[model samples]
Target: MSVTLEKVDLSLKYTAYYKQVKEELFEGSSDILNAQRSKAFQSFVMQGIPTRKNENYKYTNLHPSFSPEFSFAHSKTEKEADLQEIFRCDVPQLNTTLAFVYNGWFSRKSSAIDQLPKGVILDSLESISKQQPELLSRYASLADPEEDPMVAMNTAFAKDGFFVYVPKGVVLENAIQIINLMEGSSDMFTTQRNYIYVEEGAKLQLLLCDHSENQNNYLSNSVTEVFVGSNAELEFYMLQNQHNKATNIHSVFVEQQRDSRVTTHTASLHGGLIRNNLKFILDGENCEANMYGMSFLDKKQHVDNFTQVIHAKPHCVSNQLYKNVLDEQSTGAFAGRIHVVRDAQKTNAFQRNNNLLLTDEATMQTKPQLIIDADDVKCSHGATVGQIDEEALFYLRARGLDEGKARLIMMNAFAHEVIQEIKLEPLRERIDELVDKRLKGELARCHDCSYGKDC
Candidate 1:
């Protein structure tokens, strides 16, 4: 299953493929999306694939993941089964406004969203561009294609993604859930570019679930851009559970205005190779941002999470926490950076990363950074990578528990700090149940076709 592309193949092969599919890529696309394809392709050509030589990607090697030749997903495939009936969140007491994305294209079922609020827009990016182009005017404004090749590649190849816009002074009590499903009969690649906008004094909660079916080899590059206006609040959460043959590059950029607040949580349960890039720019006074992430890995999985927060204005606060648990020969990494501009006074930033290695071969690397140019800012960061506490395990064993149970209890306790921070009660409980099952060597039920409790 391991494939390698030589240096020439890695560079020229992708370049040639892009040219071969030039017409398909631009067919039925919005002017906003097609206008930047040329420049974005040029940037991708210059940057190429990232490797360990890059300081930010020093731990994870992505070249081999790209070696596999895959057919790109230009449009939605024929639906064999109803996605809603085949897949459901199955969380008790969890009510949500649900939507589905088949491969990289938003499903037609989702386009007919019902029971919506007034002045709220949630629809396909391509449809919105054609119907109301002004809604997506802020697309790609926060993400920089020139800096990261993955972003550039998505910018160049992505035709459409989901879009959401909330009018000023409106608050939606129900949470919006978007399930992104990747299923195919052969190896394939997908790209999705989502844009979200919340006007002043509006509130919204969004949840994204990523799942794969049929065990096909899938590689997806998804980018999301969010803007929180003055006096607005937004809560975002992502759950990733897929087969081991999947690779994902998830990027998110958030920009907050004055007196706005944003909180995001990400849980990585299973995947072959996962890379998460999250950045926040606090562009106004009295803005706050909080981010939390956790990963559970086994087998030959590899996960890397990189984050950055820029405090560009005074009186802004930011906090970040990420934890990982690795078993077997799995490996993971975390790199978090916080930056305070020279003129941003009275800023407070904090970051922490912790990891637990369950086996001798398991590996973890953590780096926490803080760059403070303001004289009156307060900043701090810390990281730790080690095994679980033997004393705690022994104590649990002495209380008539077996070794495996004792270890599981300790690991669960360590991860509870981040899980308890989730604001959704049903989601928090479901994740707890899923984590317990994952620790017990059983995957969760969203994509497990058996429909049995054990996968």
Candidate 2:
């Protein structure tokens, strides 16, 4: 059966809210800028909204979230104390932080920038658009949504976001962390956009955390673009720990030049329904890309991760590994595609996805594809869907280990491969804690089952 796209039913209140944003576009704004905004608005209206039929969104059903009209929220009732409480509950350390409060507002008071090195630019989208329009035009023009509808939507409605630019030969001494807090109490639709540029020979590390308050049933549409110049290196980490009532559509686009290296680690812990699109293009020779993801879902949470790695130049390498653990009636999906162009000889690409289902009702769909047009290339793809190893569990049990402890150990071990990829010690430990917490919760609900084999 084909799913249908229903237009959102907006109330009179939200209708005025939409008109407000439209008015803000040209409110005392320059004619040239107003014209660009008008063009983008027209494009957005032409595209309308994305639906399940879109190949990238086939596995993720978003109609339920999009059908309801939402207003654009500008503020939240959250105070510093409230934000602090949230930080303590979700993430503890609070070291090296960049924050996007409410929807797209950057909070300098709640963030730390002491560790950033010289020549690194971390500013809001508004400031960048006014101060560095050339850079914005360069990268924004390169953002094409024909491959992913979410990208198109984000660009069309990008009002606020973070921008990072690293000058050539500058190696940041610390990791850049971005925390996005979405409070759904307000009746608004939130959209954010970001542009990141790593100049030649520069090095960078970034962490992105998405969280929301108790309020649920909100929509977050976000897009990020990263450009890595020759000999540059970048490490990116994304964590989704929002309320289960929130719907999220996120996209990340990366372009790598000669001898550059880019690594991305994604962890999706909580969300009502999430659709993630990650794309990497190697445009120069000797470029390298690595992608890793880990997701834990419970209850009715649904998560989908789609990744594409394109080899447009010769002698490029790309590797991907994604693992997921689902409990209750949750669902997880992983779709990875690797493309090697005709002239991209000596391309080395590998992709793998592993899923662990703890309940009979839990479901996972994994698809790995490799399209090679070159003869001299090394490419492989694989996927596995299963539960814990019974024999391994039995051996642990025979060693006098309790069933719960044994299960936790095995689950941790299953997630260790991806966790080990995190080079930052503090971040790695934080991820470990989250993994353990999830496993403990799973163990508490588990009934009589030998290594989850019977389920």
Candidate 3:
């Protein structure tokens, strides 16, 4: 029952879907936002889905999974089960304000988000358009698809995701957790568009998790744009844990102001084919940005991480570290770029990528790039791909430890650098447990759809 569409036909299908949403579902939206959507759709039509010929997407290919016949979710889907109980987090002592988005549409049926804080606003993108359209005009469609074709596609089809706003001088103690569940009776194409704005002197933390339900094959395209005002802080964490039949293309674009700080940690634990596009623009002086990512792949799964950090102002600092653990015949790729402009003097940037291969068949490709135009800037990058250290393994084995225990110890040490970056202690512990299970092969069964345990 697999249906594949040719390139030209897929383009026409997307164009038809855009008109249907604009005329029927997205009626009465603000003119400014509507104009933005129209321009985005035009760009998308001009540039169809990207292929391996594109330099940025050379390692990742999207042709094999392009199914235009799949349903495009322009409206809500009826809940098949009680998602509230099935998708709850098992980590103890962690308190968060939960929000749910099912099949690319925000779940208005859930009762978890009945109330919010005084200075904070959390609701569906459709409602925000009717109530606070002016607030979204700036951040919505901020990411241009001309530079990235996939982003343009998302912008063209974006209907609703989440809109979060934090007023100035307010701080939220607990984290805001968003759970995105994809479940349906057939193959479908889903898109999520999210906008987050933090005013000057505000602080917030967010945990974004993606989960797939059912055994159907689907495609998920999501985009998020964030603006951080001067003296504000934002901490973001993303967990990608989907079934093997699912393909996810996710992008995040962040703009930072003077004296602002932003940190993000992305963990790819389970999925079939996953790609993450992360961009950080340091537009003001004395800003700081940190990015950390880890992916554990096995059983022919593929994961790609593309990160770019641009230092446009003086006295800004940026650091990035990405690690990958590949087993069986799994494949992984990392392409990281750090650019410092001409006038950005006193800029400090550092990037590193480390990968571990458990078997000879597992493969990894890494490219760490640095482009500096300023004389006073400090920049460095390095990458290493290899197996476990023989000497270290022998050291542990000599102390009466079994071979399995010794290998697990070394693997833990290799991933500890990126895992330790998690600021929340409880969350860090939860990730540690999962990684431990991953290395021990207990989590290997997640690729099979029949395994119903919480992966």
Candidate 4:
């Protein structure tokens, strides 16, 4: 039987919320856009919220973290100076930046687009919808909410967000960093939608960072849709660091054309509860995609990384590698799914998930699945969950290295596989720093737990 949203209560809530927001925000918009949003919202309302029973969300529960109601208000405060301060504190050396300040207002001052080449359009979605309505209408139509409820929520309450368009044959030299910042007093529900279109033979890099400061009971539901044309190449990265009291749901949808290449990397450092949905549809021949993710959870933090790669054409290739480090009472979930459609001959796809448990109380669930409808396709998936290697540790100690230092070295080596895949120097350095800090702290914790000796 086909799964539908009518069987869930959260689906009802999503439907109700979509209706209210549709009337308030999207009523007078273009009829075509409204119809698309309506269909997506209806799909969300019918499917309801994902739960453990859902194969895609078997390891992560969405009910408890998403129960709070979010308001649909463009609440911009007078403290622009204060909010600006928070943005600069994160990555001061970042040259090309795009800031999306929701629950306050979008700002152009904080963004650096002076060096962007001609034929490349980088602006807010709100402005694009007004100035270039046709492009917005065409690209916005690509989002499908029935397949993803969080995406539907973002569309129904779509506010301000960054938009990028690369004209045919254009190659961007520098990376574009899109940062979403949310801060407020009342219970805030901020929804931002972004659309990126890379024309034929165009190449670009996009970095997305989600963050908030001192916001209690805040919800950030974001959706980003990308279109990669023939022979185009695009690299996308996401970094999420939010307050412990906040909740985040981030969704990314990409459609790749013939001979296109796409790469995505996601790093989750801290959050109260976080869920990421990364999906890609290889709709053309000879398309390639690579997805990598790493998450570090500590102190009761929860994180879920869900990825799906669909091979709809022949001669397509996809590779996914995800790693998680759990400490204290934290929990981590990794679910990677690969679907090969019929007639998608000679497809090559591989997915792997590895987890490292730093504490006895830390928990993790990993499920990697492959659904093959084509007989000629080669696809495989594997998952492993284990603690530190005791034999390896003893060997390192026997080599005259202190136990604590030995453990840190092994931990870094364990995570180096995914870290080495990062092509950008700035991002790689930042990730190295975060990983080093976590490893040091974990080593200290282990020393304290042990009786004056490293384990």
TM-score of each: 0.96, 0.88, 0.93, 0.87
lDDT of 2 at 288: 95
Query: Lowest summed lDDT over 10 consecutive residues: which window, candidate 1?
Result: 446-455
lDDT of 2 at 170: 95
| lDDT of every predicted structure (CA atoms) | 0.86, 0.75, 0.83, 0.75
After superposition, which runs of candidate 2 have C-alpha atoms over 4 Å from their true positions?
Answer: 1-20, 25-47, 74-97, 113-115, 138-140, 442-455
Off by over 4 Å in 1: 1-5, 78-80, 110-112, 446-455
Clashes of 3: 0
Candidate 4 per-residue lDDT over residues 14-73, each given as its tens digit: 576666555656643444345556666666666667767767677777776666765655
Flag the better candidate by lDDT, 2 or 3: 3
Worst 10 residues of 2 by lDDT: 446-455
Candidate 1: clashing pairs of residues: none
TM-score of 3: 0.93
lDDT comparison, 1 vs 3, better candidate? 1
By summed lDDT, the worst window of 10 consecutive residues in model 4 runs over 446-455
lDDT of 2 by residue, 201-250 (tens): 99988888876655646788888889999999999988887656788888
- Model 3 has an lDDT value of 0.83
Best-first order by TM-score: 1, 3, 2, 4
- Identify the candidate with maximal TM-score: 1
